[model samples]
Target: MPGESVEYVVVHPDTPVGPVVGLFLLARSLEDAEEIGATVCGRALRTRAELSGFLLLGCEGRLVGPYFDRLLGWAPAGRVMPRPDHDSGNPFLDF
Candidate 1:
């Protein structure tokens, strides 16, 4: 399992209407995915006051929305995709 990774969908669960933000991440486990997702979101909140109340809703193995199609277009089967760097700009904008 050296190169194994799973695709996860992370969202902000408390949105009044629905999750306006969706984060896609590749990680070794569900817990790792959630942590990474939360960390990324936390950093964004530091700069964007409007996102203060939002938090990482959760991470799930299933892909959702446009992220699914976007992944299929670029990610190869059974290959671990690279995780975004801490300073790699805003990932949320990519979604």
Candidate 2:
């Protein structure tokens, strides 16, 4: 199960309704992936007061959103993947 990977897309808190812009990461399960996404968004909300809120719009077993679309003109791709030598003590730093 550890070898298996799942891609999850989280909508940006600012645009929870549409335009779907947020972070994405690969994890072993939906829960882990969602937690990581939430953690990142949480930190963003804490440091950047501009953020309206944090929310998990949706998640799937495969990648989603306009990650590779040139016409969409979305921000540069920012994908978080687990490091081989990641520290289990700190999940946030695993990426």
Pick by lDDT: which candidate is best?
Answer: 1
Best by TM-score: 1
Per-residue lDDT over 28-66 for candidate 1, one digit per residue giving the tens place of the 0 to 100 score = 666676666666666677879877776655544343546
Task: Report the alpha-carbon TM-score of model 2 versus the true structure.
Answer: 0.37
- Tell me the deviation in Å of residue 54 in model 2: 7.0
TM-score of each: 0.40, 0.37
Looking at model 1, which ten-residue stretch has the lowest summed lDDT? 1-10
Per candidate, the number of residue pairs that clash is: 0, 0
Model 2 lDDT vs. the true structure?
A: 0.50
Residues 1-95 of candidate 2 have per-residue lDDT tens digits of: 24324243345435546545444556766677766666655556677766666444553334454554533454334433434433556434432
* Model 1 TM: 0.40
